[model samples]
Target: MEFDYIIIGAGSAGCVLANRLSADPHISVCLLEAGPEDTSPLIHTPVGVAAILPTRHVNWAFNTTEQRGLNNKLGYQPRGKTLGGSSSINGMIYIRGHRTDYDDWKALGNTEWGYEEVLPYFRKSESYYGGTNQYHGTEGELFVSRLQLHGVTKDFIEAGISAGHSHNADFNGEEQEGVGAYDVTIHKGKRWSTASAFLKPIREQRSNLKVITGALAERIILDGKKAVGVSIRQKGKSRQLKARKEVLLSAGAFGSPHLLMLSGIGPAEELAPQGIAVLHELPGVGQHLQDHPDVVISYRSPDTSLLGVSVSGSAKIGATLWQYLRHKTGSYASNCAEGGAFLKTDPNLDRPDIQLHSVIALLDDHNRKLHWGHGFSCHICVLRPKSVGSVGLTSSDPAVAPKIDPNLLGQEEDLQTLLKGYRMALEIIKQAPMAKYQLQDIYSADALTDEQLSEVIRARADSIYHPVGTCKMGRDENAVVDSHLKVHGIDNLRVVDASVMPTLVGGNTNAGTIMIAERAAEWIMQDQATA
Candidate 1:
């Protein structure tokens, strides 16, 4: 059956597209999600992000094949497989990233994506509890609220301030630099993902919007050079759904570009070797992979930190359960990542070279295996990494995960920046207010000198969970899509997710991804009107 629009992958962008596009009663929209419905209780609780990470219920637990940069250790990369995508299971920090990040997008030939032009779209998608202002809008769907910090978390924030960094209450407000507790995509202590904010309210109201869960799209169906429809696998049966107007790909950084290549629209040289016939030799479909790599600096605390207490004993579990029953507040309510900072690793750098995520717990290896006992830790990540990477097909089969080579720590300067960030984190732990906790360096800072620490930084650094630019947007020869997120050679198709980002944002990628979707929805609707 043909529809006005067929949006693929019901993630952050796809949910917004369904809500906005289906607003017109006359236009019919079909939204497809590869995973199941987002019914898990863990999804609503902001703190439940940890419990769902290892499971495949709403997660695509993808791992990289032994990164040479990280001493050949394979890093785990998790993406959301539910209706809300990664938004369903992610650290709920509500960061829009630096304004300069967006300005850089305009500089890269995407004129319609300047900071000034994109600000309205950011505002249009937010319902900030901090109130309406020039920088924020309170009348939108997604919830943005002030963080409810615990006693230990409060101490960590002061520790950052006592170390010479000023406290900036709101990262999304006036300035982004400095250490402070972060605002999150939570409201009154509950998670407010795109499913909660955008989809729930309009799901029943919009009969024109048909949502299909557990429908995995194999590839785009092409008629000549244009994307006519999508071929999907549902209940072990292959079905074809046509898009009368357009087939919008909002499958995110990994999925969108993979689908593009699967449909025979990627680089000819790369595709021909795999025995896949190239319908279009668009060289940049699955290139330009970018992510923020984080290194941890751990410290043993005076008392059992939030991290220790959460995993301790039956008493701790009982107390948290009682607290949650009584007031919907306690250990369970806090997203482990309580505070963070945007700082410059070197004073001479153009902007903040590193971003810090101060977690109330101690984690090692991205918290999958090996956690520290009764300790606190800080994650120092190199924002705007100089390192570049790529995503490519591992096999001809569409079911196989793509080979993701982030090429982390490839540059000498990247190793230096991370080491500097580690040193800065240690300096913060030594400050007076923070020192009251009597923090002990469990990671053994004294054991490693400056030179050795750089080695450790390169060996242990992992992604801060922000991945973008697989399908970069620009006008260059290597560009996959144009400024409007439309594929350069294909008509009536658009890639409107984080895949369209020419580079990763300065901070968390969620807010920027949502903003892109919001703006893209406007562009699509406007184009439809003109057509």
Candidate 2:
């Protein structure tokens, strides 16, 4: 089979690309996904993320190499494997990140990626429930709305305000500092994944677009330095699909770099060891990895309104389930991490360097650890960690998982920043609004010194699930893609996903990734007109 464009992953970015590129009836596009269709009941239910996240139901469930920073413990990375990708399984918090995040990208030589140039693309992909404004779009495919607040979530926000942080109604608005409820991607009580927002509505209508699930991509078929097609194994059968014009890789940060190395388009030294011949020696294929290293400060609260395991809690959930089935309201309609804040660790910093997530349940070790009763937890993370890591091949075969090493807290500054953030989180929880519930600290003691807190950070901190910049875009030798998202030193190939980010954004990456695809699709269409 041949197509004008072959998209390697039917993820958040790929779905948007499929929708926009195929909108032109004359253009034929093919999207390949390693996972199954987004059909699970858990995927559609907003609160079902609790069940889906801790297990491999629809997740990649990739584990990182033992991190020396975290006392040599392996970190869990649960990426969504369905059509919508991570967006299908994520917390659903909609954040475009601090504006300066994009400004920093432009300063790093990606001239067209400044915040002002990219804001329109962000607006173009959103249908804000708050109606159209300078910061939001009202007529886009994806829906964005405020989370249905629980009493505890309201208290968390109040506590933040009482703790000296101003209340920010919109984190994606004029400024990204202070505490508030997050705008989520949930709509009509369902998880509004990219597949739901972009692909499903148009799938039956577009005959020019072909979407294939359960297809594992093996390698890019290269004609010298140009990518011509992809070799994939689907249903135990080998097949080769050619691309008439371009092959776009939206396989995400890990998959994109891993596939490039398997296809011999990465660092020669790394490929030679894996028994793969070098096709293109791009040393930065899997370098500059970044993730938000987080620590959860949990407390056992007397508040039974929060989600947890107990007779009353279970009964509440049962009732909530019934309510959801009937009217799509109540706790079942909530995304677990409902309220959040972006704050500065140091008052001197230009922007907030730390982010907070207030969960309505005791979330320990990504919810893999079970607590007996009701509780509340606050997740604090260094928004822009100075530490960097890499993603490398564990085996030459595509069936093997990549050796992920986020190297969380590998830098001293990150650890110091986290320590301060930890104190801040504790102070907020102890504020009058939250203290009225009489929550007991379950993770740490008040007597623990800064040094003790640093040790705790080193032991408990792990990724908040945002990993990016492995295939960064820049003009430097380390760059894998150019400003137009086309792979450098290679023709007819482009990487349009989070992997192309030159630096990690300051907040949730889903919104930023969709914006990238919106921009990329427009550029591709413009190029097609000239071609």
Best by lDDT: 2
After TM-score superposition, the amount by which residue 356's alpha carbon in candidate 2 deviates from its true location, in angstroms, is 0.1
* Candidate 2 segments whose C-alpha is farther than 4 A from its true place: none
Residue-level lDDT of model 1, residues 153-262, one tens digit each, is 78777888888888988888778888988888887678888988888899988889999999988889999988899999899899999999999999888888888888
Stretches of candidate 1 above 4 Å error? 309-313, 370-372
Clashes of each: 0, 0
The TM-score leader among the candidates is 2
- C-alpha displacement of 79 in model 1, angstroms? 0.5
lDDT of each: 0.84, 0.93
Candidate 1 accuracy as TM-score: 0.97
Clashes of 2: 0
- Decoy 2 TM-score against native: 0.99
lDDT of 2: 0.93
